[model samples]
Target: MTAERTRALQERFGNALMPTYGVPPVAIARGEGARVWDVDGRPYLDLIGGIAVSALGHGHPALVKAVADQTAALAHTSNLFLHEREVELAERLIALLGDPGARVFLANSGTEANEAALKLARKAAGPARPVLVATENGFHGRSLGALAVTGKESMRAPFGPYGTEVRFVPHGDAGALRAAVDDTVAAVIVEPVQGEAGVVPAPDGYLAAVREICDAAGAAFVLDEIQSGIGRTGHWFAHQAQGVRPDVLTLAKGLGGGLPIGACVGFGRYATAFAKGDHGSTFGGNPVAAAAALAVLDTVENEDLLGSAARTGAALAEGMRATGHPLVAGVRGTGLWLALVLTAERAAEVQARAADHGFLINAVAPDALRLAPPLTLTPEQAASFTGALPAILDEVNP
Candidate 1:
């Protein structure tokens, strides 16, 4: 009977919603902790974590309270007036970045944060620098401005020319980055861990090398940490672990603990790139989102979820590796973010099998299954998924 409800909702979804995302098989009804229940009333362990956005997991009390209280108090003030929560959030993010002198511009999503970064870089470069360097296969956002820097050809093909010269180079090749960024370059944008490219991480010292190259070429170093930031990689920001600082940092995914909030932060001189009335957002740093973000930050610190994420992620990676299944090649990524690499391109089949067994994982690539469970995921919860893996793999048609 509940399955009929799921089917009915899906049918309605197909008719009402745009075809951009296609029809998902399961219709989620509600969630708590690291598990969610579909409309069919079937519980599934959530390993996807809303694509690494649910830092504290579903129905987290701190997040719930913050959002509730803030909404009840003052939801939207438009950008016309300033609010305390927004200022506090910006200050907290700058503190987390370890640069007290930095400045922040909040937006509604990662793409918008990145768009702000692009505008800052362009404004900084002015007419002298006309080129932007980005790594190949890098996924920033689908918006036209962010899409221009995004490395995927297929996604950018539909939009045609984006009125910007984006020079694409091989991922993790510092030499190529150096060759691309010269006096004519405005900025170089890259992700420490390329989340969409099957959770591929940059080689050791690659980010620091980019920083050096950008400094030498007088180009801004922009780090897109939308997926790898907010303790997903066991660090406040992935760049922090590398001991490399960026001129601009774009963040969103887990910043607000599932609330829609993104920030583009500028450090030192980059902070002054925008003059008065340079850029603004209508609902960017609304009080509710800022309050939600504060709660997430406070919870991460108070609960020591950063330590929890590191420990649980290690256990999950180790368990997956120890399974010794033939189809299982290896695991990639760090902290709570991970990807199970398969020997063959059968991730979709495995994902379906996993779903059948009351688990939810993402087939990020043909041969890669992404696992980004919440920071609150316990050892037992992780073990359950790992224990079920061999059986799930065995059932797949070879």
Candidate 2:
């Protein structure tokens, strides 16, 4: 009966929804902690965490209460007036950035936040500098402005003529980056960890090199931490570990604990770049989202989830390596954001097999299964996944 219900729901979804994401195999009904239930009431251990957006997991009391309380009091202010939640959220973000002078522009998603940062870069560049430098295979967002600086060819191919002139360089090649940025460059945008390009991380001192180049070239150093930020990397922000700061930073994904929210922050003088009426969002920083974000932040600190993420992630990686499965090549990434690298391009098969075994993982690439599980994932839950992994891989390979 449940299978029939799931099939009927899938049919309805296919009939009603657009084909942007194709048809999902399972229709999720609800979730809690690191697991979710499908419409058929079947449970699956959720490791992707809604693409790293569900920081506190589904139905977290703090997030739920914050949203409910804020919605009851106030929901939308439209940026026409000031609201305390928005102000508080911005202040909290600046504090987390360790830059008291930084200013934030809240948006609904990473794409919109990137758009704002790109605009700030253009303004900072003025007319003399019009070129933007970005890393090859970097995925920023789908919007035209964000896509202009995004270095992925296939994503940018369909939408040509993305007005701004952009120079793409190798992801971690400092020499290539230095050669690309010159007097004509406005900003250099990159991700600390290239999440979309198969969970790859920047080499040591790479961010510092970018900072030095940007400083010499008088270009804004923009870090897009949409996926790597908000304690996903065991640090409040990924750049904190690098000992370098960016002139502008974009954040989203885990900030709102499943609510839609994003922020584009400008540091020092760049903080005042917008001036009067430069940019705005209708539902950006709605009270409920702000409250949800604040709750997430509070929970992170009170529960010390940063430490938890580090410990669990290390143990999980070690266990996967100990499995010594021939299909398993290695594990990459830090904290809860990881990719199980496989020897062959059987990630899709492995992902399907894992799902059949009551686990939900993302086949981010042909050979990489990305894990962006909730920070609340318990050690036992992680161990269960690791324990089941060998059998899953064997079922796929054998």
Candidate 3:
């Protein structure tokens, strides 16, 4: 939080890294629990949780031990060889899906997981079905195949010609989604909560409707739960609330805590769609990452974080709304991944001021502030930010 530490990180980042993400303002030296210290030793409560990662918080002992133990034993072995860690992690993810017959493909990141699911759906649908349906403002990933399913044109138009026939429909619009899925459709991809779009949840019945549509059309139903999975939404998978099981599911973010890992799962008949020679990833399902992910899952269950996320998240949202600050228009989304909708275009200013006050939040949209604090975030930590939010908004209100 100190000006000196912020400048130091910004300078190094501008000079050393690519211009893709631009220069970030703050530099974190280390983190423990729900708080992080800057390079200059000033502390800030990390409410963004590394864009919804860090489910067990920073430097959790279980996750650290798992990574260290697995690394000391073995790290990498391509899919050409057998590894217990990969199989074990895969089994755990499928079990979370409530489908023991499901199959899984591990990847290094969410986008790769999504890419794998896209290819699997395409292969399962055969050559005649070329159309893929995605929601407007829905974000899947940045890889070409994932990008094709993502509805943001600005990000996708620059990368075309995208190598697929993907159609965009309004998110949560049942009629549009139903009309779009046909026999020629290969898959229908949607996010349970549109995290990139300020944590906007689809209407209550939208997911179930999409599942029915995909089923009737014989198209694969894919749910991208990268940001909302692994206990972030107080559920193993966000789509579970709708009581609809997707044909394929993509997950990442908090799955491996701070480590890099992702999973693409297939259920029912779709599980056997991929042939041995059809697809693969050399570094996917490595021991270290798998162990990290397993530890995250174990800690979430052992510590009862899923319950904590729901309870703490509800209290925090209520506290913020109770502030009755002029900028506080409303709050929405689920678990710890809620968004504070602002009445004015002061979200960027609020974000900066909140950081100055030792709180790390994200201005996910011009009028919305996103909070994805660690699932282990205690009531006291939530109160800290919620208590300071009124002043933060006031300081930026002009």
Please name the candidate that would achieve the greatest lDDT relative to the true structure: 1
What tens-digit string does per-residue lDDT give for candidate 1 at 1-398? Answer: 33898999999999999999999977999999999999889999999999999999999999999999999989999989999999999999988888888999999999999999999999988999989999999999999999998899989999978999999998999999888888999999999989998999889999999999998999999999999999998888889899999999999989988899999999878898999899999999989999999999999999998899899999999999999999999999999999999999999999999999999999999999999988999999999999999999999844
- Against the unseen true structure, what C-alpha lDDT does each candidate score? 0.93, 0.92, 0.90
Clashes of 2: 0
TM-score of 3: 0.98
Per-residue alpha-carbon lDDT of candidate 2 for residues 346-371, written as tens digits (9 for 90 to 100): 99899889988999999998999999
Q: Which ten contiguous residues of candidate 1 have the minimum total lDDT?
A: 1-10
lDDT of 3: 0.90
Tens-place lDDT per residue, model 3, 288-334, is: 99999999999999999999999999999999999998888999889
Which pairs in model 1 have colliding backbones? none
Global local distance difference test of model 2: 0.92
RMSD of each: 1.1, 1.1, 1.1
Q: Looking at model 2, report the run of 10 residues with the lowest lDDT sum.
A: 1-10
- Candidate 1 stretches with Cα past 4 Å from truth are none
Colliding pairs, model 3: none
